[model samples]
Target: MRRNRLLSAVVAVCATSALGFTVPQTAAADPGSTACSQMPSDLRPTLILGDTGPAVRQAQCLSNMWGGEPPKLVLDGIYGTVMLKKIEWIQVCHGIPQSGVIEDHTWEVLYHPALDCYLPYPD
Candidate 1:
């Protein structure tokens, strides 16, 4: 009878332990994973005429990567009409919709010029 009681107690403890334990959940992708997508909305109106210093640098980098040409403009960090024109040119070169806005597709092309032929996944 003592052996049986001990076995029963062991089984009960195991069951209780199992019930208290929980599996941890896996983490999702980082928030910045799709940061490029937000670039359009972030720089909407400013993308038209000109941009600031950092914007100009980003544009120049993108232009150089896409065209394999040296950046002729100065990195004054101003997104002016000239910058807008250049952006349009890039859009034309990449065969993306010429909406005059630096949308997510435009950012992808700018960031990954070498992957011009690659298409982004559907939303």
Candidate 2:
């Protein structure tokens, strides 16, 4: 239970810290297990809400491994809002803008989730 709380706080802090926008603390959710490890590693398409196909699924694979747990997703390759939020959360954690769009910076973080960077990177 404590781990969940900590991850929730991390999510909120990352999101709110991104671009100085304060996201509600309630935005956090609990999930586990990421199939992303098995998904293609080279897929870095800039996905947004409404897009679909293997690219979107690849994005989903990456996002399912952050914070407290992997977000519950269908992996149907549809870039829905849920996945969008997850991607944005990942961006926020990496001090990237929460535009909900995957860019090069996002890919950098996705490619190297452990790549330490300046905390609270300027938006």
Candidate 3:
């Protein structure tokens, strides 16, 4: 039993490490200043191009941590075309489908973004 547990732990560590999971320190949000703080906390909703609310603003802020090459997204409460493109890029970075939709999986990536995205940012 102990040996099994050890093997499981080792596999877990290796899986995470091998996936190149690194969050950029420079773009990380300060604890008290995260965009999620802009509104009262709630469950993240499925957002698309026309949605407008705190959740979209929260997503926009979290998405900014992916680095500034394509430029940071404005923390506006509205979701629009620019935000859609960014979301698509972020999906591609995570090897997810480029759906341009903020659902559970996309929200997961936004909350825990990787530091390096090899693909070029969309124009």
Mind giving the per-residue lDDT tens digits that candidate 2 earns over 39-102?
4565566767899887776656555534354355677888887777667767777678889887
Models ranked on TM-score: 3, 2, 1
**Every model's TM-score:** 0.45, 0.56, 0.70
Tell me the lDDT of model 2 at 101: 85
Model 3 backbone overlap count? 0
Q: How many residue-pair clashes does candidate 1 contain?
A: 11
What lDDT does each candidate get?
Answer: 0.52, 0.62, 0.78
**What does candidate 1's lDDT look like per residue over 1-47, in tens digits?**
99999899788778877899532211111223342232332452235
Model 2 regions lying over 4 Å from their true place: 1-40, 67-70, 114-123
Quality of model 2 by C-alpha lDDT: 0.62
Cα error, candidate 1, residue 122 (Å): 32
TM-score quality measure for candidate 2: 0.56
What lDDT score is found at residue 30 in candidate 1? 20
- Candidate 3 lDDT over 1-123, as tens digits, reads 999998997887788789976435434544334535755434668988999988898888887777758778898888999899999998998989999989989877776778778889867
